[model samples]
Target: MPDRAPQPVDRQLPTDEARDLISLVRDIAQREIAPKAAEEEDAGRFPREVFTLLSESGLLGLPYDSEYGGGDQPYEVYLQVLEELAAARLTVGLGVSVHSLACHALANYGTKEQQAEHLPDMLGGGLLGAYCLSEPASGSDAASLRTKAVRGDGGSWALTGTKAWITHGGIADFCTVLARTGGEGARGITAFLVPGDAEGLSAAAPEKKMGMKGSPTAQVHFDGVRISDDRRIGEEGQGFAIALSALDSGRLGIAACAVGVAQAALDEAVAYATGREQFGRPIADFQGLRFMLADMATRIEAGRALYLTAARLRDAQRPFARQAAMAKLFCTDTAMQVTIDAVQVLGGYGYTADFPVERYMREAKVLQIVEGTNQIQRMVIARHLAGPESR
Candidate 1:
């Protein structure tokens, strides 16, 4: 469970800029974040100071535009930075991913006026952000979210309903919320930027989860919270589209995190195999164990390639929803497999907290569940394949 040094890999070629950013992130991960990961996870603590360090280092805004005080870094570079963070601590890395998801609506759909008002504080502030799309009755059925945003006096809107399973719900400064604005179904929805402190807005106590203990999850409630019309992202009926778009990008983040988790698990297994004596020789020297390591490495490499390809397509402004789903499905499943195999390699020790593989195994399960479950990803891919007439 001790923090491991970043091992140099020959295949991980990086441009000068990427090299500099990776070096900076890896240093921070080892020197600051990794040391605190175990204690924080055990206490179910959120790392506010770590987020502040990331913001000050400009890591929070890695893939955003510089015009709004962001880093303007490429997706390729941003993803590598995320991988380093996730490898050190999954909670911190996922916090960054959710924060980025919350900011995407503003960056992509907000008008100049709205962006001017919020993006600077959103990207530069110490407080994190949350994406409020799921409801008690809806998780994968996002378009069926029952939260309502009724038009109010003076061009404002009154929001009322609960957003369930919100990441950083209690800790966030702001939320990108989706609510029903018209009739039923997708066209009835609208995306709104609601301040966390706005009247009638509150979060339930954090949920006790199986893993990612350091990341707080809660239910967000909006009881007639009034927000100005200007806070609406895009037009009425655009909420579904906006939410889907944000999720496509969010899936890439999840995929990158999965790769990191797998990589961490694989690295641990490799080290243990080499050091642990089996019968008379090192376990790593056995052909059977060596083949398992080979498979784990191949799977991790494939996951990395898949996510990077999806990210490149996104950055190029191309249609990438299918690609995103593909990456998420592949990477998460790979993480699940690699983490399980990592435990097997360690025999009895892997199942115990004495080793990190057990924790990684638990953590990897949620990756398959969140950001749209693997089943949902398959549905998405099928729809893309069957064309518009399929639906």
Candidate 2:
């Protein structure tokens, strides 16, 4: 095969339409989200009213097809909306990202009947969703999950196991649950659309997470929960692939959220430097502080570019797992670094909840862990390079 021409650098600069989304996001984030962020985060409360507002504004389904009640916007536009939301409140931004992840199984792998039954509630209303894949025994090695779903009388299956670290575990109306059906390893896995209110299904008390507090995380326990065979997404052995695919898209959302947090950190750093005077002059007037701000801005720009490039590949129906991993790893790490520097720039003030930079710093740390940790991302990238023999 001949070598292909190098693909053009995927850019993510705002278009006319993207600008309109940005304007709308800014207005809602400022007028609605920002004011409530502290109250909700402190109380570990989910922002139901804010989510209702997002649904009403058509911001919840920005990347899905318009025929499905989505905003019909491109991933680039959707990501910017997430970034703006993250800049205002990490809780809501992550909640949106998790909902999109939950929607992925139905959107990409669901049969016509499943999509018709599920997509509208997920893509149109204020309803939230949870993607249930991780379990107590499985995290990075998801193929090793032991959640079992044995066929029962008639055409039903009884699912039994615990799904750990589920976002929106208790609050979501629905979940895309992955469970084993046939044998060991990934091929035995199957994805099931389990209702939150299903019999024998219960959510544990929320975990006391270190950050992104308002976004509820808990363990979902299924003790012989019955689901119809029709609820299975794709074939019986396709759950692993579907879960991976959903995480691939979910990673891009996390990357966008990271960019938003980093952007917020950069803005806060600039504002503080310009306001806090030292040596009879604003700190921002110093070349040292100015260089740091420049670096933070540059990092955010590069992270944005990588995520958009990967998202374009996804939108165009191209192979993008490696690219998605790259974006998630780079952008999340950049968010951590930039937020740390933002705190450093403020000295003592940045360490307190009195300033938003401290909250942003705490929030950025989790981006590195969720939607496949950065370490897992590097493994995915390396496997792509190590050839077919590696896996």
lDDT of each model, Cα atoms only?
Answer: 0.89, 0.86
| Residue ranges of candidate 2 with Cα displaced over 4 Å | 1-16, 388-391
Q: Model 2, range 305-367, lDDT digits (tens) per residue?
A: 899899888878899999999999999999999999999999998898877777888889989
- Report the number of the highest-lDDT candidate: 1
| lDDT per residue (tens digit) for residues 194-254 in model 1 | 8889999999999999998989999999999998999999999999999988999899999
Total backbone clashes of candidate 1, pairs 3 or more residues apart or in separate chains? 0
TM-score of 2: 0.94
Every model's Cα RMSD, please?
1.4, 6.6
- What's the residue-level lDDT of 386 in candidate 2? 84
What's each prediction's TM-score?
A: 0.97, 0.94
